[model samples]
Target: MPVTKLYIDKEVEDYSNVREFSSRIDLEGEIVDDQQVIFDIIQESSDPIQKAKEVIFLTRNKGAFIKKCPGTSIYTCCGYKILHIGTFCDMDCSYCILQTYFHPPIMQYFVNHIDMMTELDRIFEEKAIHRVGTGEFTDSLIWEKWTDIASKLVTKFSKQNNSILELKSKTVNIKKLENLNHNGKTILAWSMNTPHVIKEEEKDTTPLKARLRAAQKVESWGYKLAFHFDPMVFYDNCHEEYKDVVRQIFKNVSPENVAYISIGSFRFMPDLKQIIQKRFKESTLVYGEFIHGLDNKMRYFKPLRLKMYQAIVSEIKLLAPDVLVYFCMEDDEIWEKTFGFVPDKDEGLSKMLDKRVAKLCGLNKGLLI
Candidate 1:
């Protein structure tokens, strides 16, 4: 979606990143003091949540830039670290948690590079392998249109030897990354869904074919690739559609080049249903055969989720037996039933991903980069 307006924080008016972004992002709307102020302003509006989507708030964050993901122990967590660059997304997916996550759901970008890098310095000093990603709070590359965030992050991670940066997105903003020297330390990932889901649910995102093509472009540029069939929407005859997506992925890029592929069925918090229903009146993707799961969120019936996961996992294994395939936010029981084993036998989810990083990107305990 085109940013119709810009909300600049007064504190960072002279900041270089702010100046750079202000020059590109359309500055055509009412300015607010900051993100919270913007939320307050929108609250009195006719539709605060909807209006919030039109404005982009630029501010300097006053917290730790890097933090551990809030993965619950109820499920086998991925143990991935989250780089909290920003919150909310530009895309209008039907099942977005941000719809109810924030009162107004403003698209906020924290422009404090010095502090962010300072925290990362500590992580880099640790000898342990840390797998970090920027997609936890927002679409990783949404800042591509307004700032040099992706290129800067890639460049920063390039010099690091232990941790690999995963930049996941639903957009095709690979222009800035195509020529960068990433040192094979950055995984260019995309959250993909079936073409039908893309068309009906993932509003304003790059089409499935376009996203795959973008991934192919980055793969040719020597960057490791990853994919997530996350929130894999369940619909009529989803088996063939998902299978087609899996095949097309390998067709566009080699399996050897793919670092990992994560498969997850559609799951959401109970509070999210009304927001999705209100925001996307035509969408029924959230109204599936859902039951309350261990995490207190509504999930597809275990047997149903197992069926879909089993089918997709089977197809992926048949095509690329050696590739690392895993589930996102799923429990050990689901893993055992579907894959015939859990990740516990092989260290854990975090170490497994680290091993994938070491094997695919050539990082190891002996050699850093």
Candidate 2:
């Protein structure tokens, strides 16, 4: 559903972004002091999650905009920094954790660009290899129609040499990025899944072929690419299906241009089980073999996850041996069994990614390049 209602926070009512977005939106925005009023309105709907997507709350980000990924202690972290651009997405995925992550699950876009840029300036000044992304909280390209934030960010990152900005999304809004002077400082990424999974579980998303076509377009523009096969569902012939996805990825873009590819099996918090049952009544994703993991979430049994990972990793290595392939949240056992080695404990996965960034993005971090 498109955004039909707009709510502007009283504190950010006078910001320039508010005026620009308000003019672009055909609907009249209602300026409000308390956000509870919007929450109460959404609570009365039969489907509040769907209702939340229909309205946007533009507010100031009173806190820090840059934050570290909240990786669990038991899992290997990628040491990525999150540029908290917004909260919640417009698309509806049956297995989306955001459905139960936020209270009442409202869609919010922060209008405080001054504060956001100030934080990014600090990151650019530091002599470090930083992988920053805006897709952690929401789809990175969903705001392209109403705002020029993506263009602004890509331009700013182009002028720097210490960090790379990654824009990950399921949308094909690359028209604005084509003419930018990114200077190898921006990476375009996608969250890829099988056609069966996309059609059944993911809704209101670009099709698999369309997303790949967009990736090809971005590659032609000379940008480094990344693909993530996350939440890989377990089902009959799932191994073959995932291998096919790996095949399609290399078929579209060269392995030499790929910065990294990550694989993670389907895992969910216990609270999300009920939400999936209540909202997606026909979904069988929760029926797979599950066990309580170290982080207290329900994950596929280790053997099952290992089987899938081995098949997928073997296919990727066969096709693109030099491309970096890593697991998202798997443990040492999975790494040792699948790849015959584990990352060093001190630098671990983060160091591996930093080296890739320096080599591919040409950052002078004193690591690889």
Candidate 3:
């Protein structure tokens, strides 16, 4: 969390919560006249992308807090809901879409918790099974040093019976969560990768062993867990390394405590390639065997991706076969070839995940439980 500069929204300067959030930080603060200051800072930066992580923005989310995941119809979608808490991350990953998804990616912390609570209250009243998460746009736990955002969301979801909150991050920030009355309504998840990948590609993230140790602590605290082997890169000796990662997972926590596991191959938009090329020229990920997908992103060749996934899925099944395993934004051909059937055919992927949530966390009456 190298927040060298802080930009406070003028409108939120008087709010006590915002004031409290900014009080303990050591960085110098500037009272911005308006949100345009964001664009100005980006335009003025000598290196906008790098400078983006060097600064933090304390602002309000004027838009709706809740949004549907922008899943493509060309694939079998999971239908997960995104709680737009904030955008951008403090950590740097060579394969991160944040570098290209948002121009001049900035670490934004929405100070308006009331707006978030208001939206969540409405969703809880709807009483429909919903799989909601705060990790879509940012590392959900990155703002823990200044804000109790993770604690607040956990407490709120504890009393709800229809929706479960998934806080996914590469960092180990689970201290605030252990004391909260989450009532198994929260899924404490970690993004897993090989030690080689973590050391080479993921910058400033917790080490793999430390992340698993944190998961062990959270599991002991009685929170249901989840893991994502996403952006599963097809690098040198990746198969054995990933298999070892799966073994490490079961070594730390029981399979029954897991809510689900998600696996996704590395896929990114075309423009992101240039950003990686310019920003991380030494990265070999950009030079891998890739083909343009229906969604216009460059993905690994089908057979190659399947080989990598098959190796990983086989390892995971050996350790935790009963744990629900799914892909992130892949098509029917990939799913059918990998699992012998598409999850979309029996019941929608979203429904299956929701049922997992309901069964594991007691969100509602689900057969899986």
Best-fitting candidate, scored by TM-score: 2
lDDT of each: 0.85, 0.90, 0.87
After superposition, candidate 2 runs with Cα above 4 Å error: 367-369
Clashing residue pairs in candidate 3 (N, C-alpha, C atoms within 3 angstroms): none
Question: What is candidate 1's lDDT per residue for 221-302, written digit by digit as tens?
Answer: 9999999999887888998889889999989999998989998888888888887787788998776788888889899888
Residue-level lDDT of model 3, residues 1-369, one tens digit each, is 477888888888877767777786776678898767786787698767888887888889999889998988887777788999888988889889988878657777887889899999999888478889999999989878888889989999999798989999999988888778889999999999999989888988999999999999999999999999998988879999999999999999999999999999999999888888888877888898789999999999999889988998998889998999999888898898888888755447888898878989997763332
Sorted on lDDT, best first, the list reads: 2, 3, 1
Higher-TM-score candidate of 1 and 3: 3
Using all chains and alpha carbons, the TM-scores for the candidates as numbered come to 0.95, 0.98, 0.97
Model 1: CA > 4 A from native: 28-36, 345-347, 367-369
| TM-score quality measure for candidate 3 | 0.97
> How far off is residue 359 in model 2, in Å?
0.4
Candidate closer to the true structure by lDDT (higher is better), 2 or 3: 2
- How many clashing pairs in candidate 2? 0
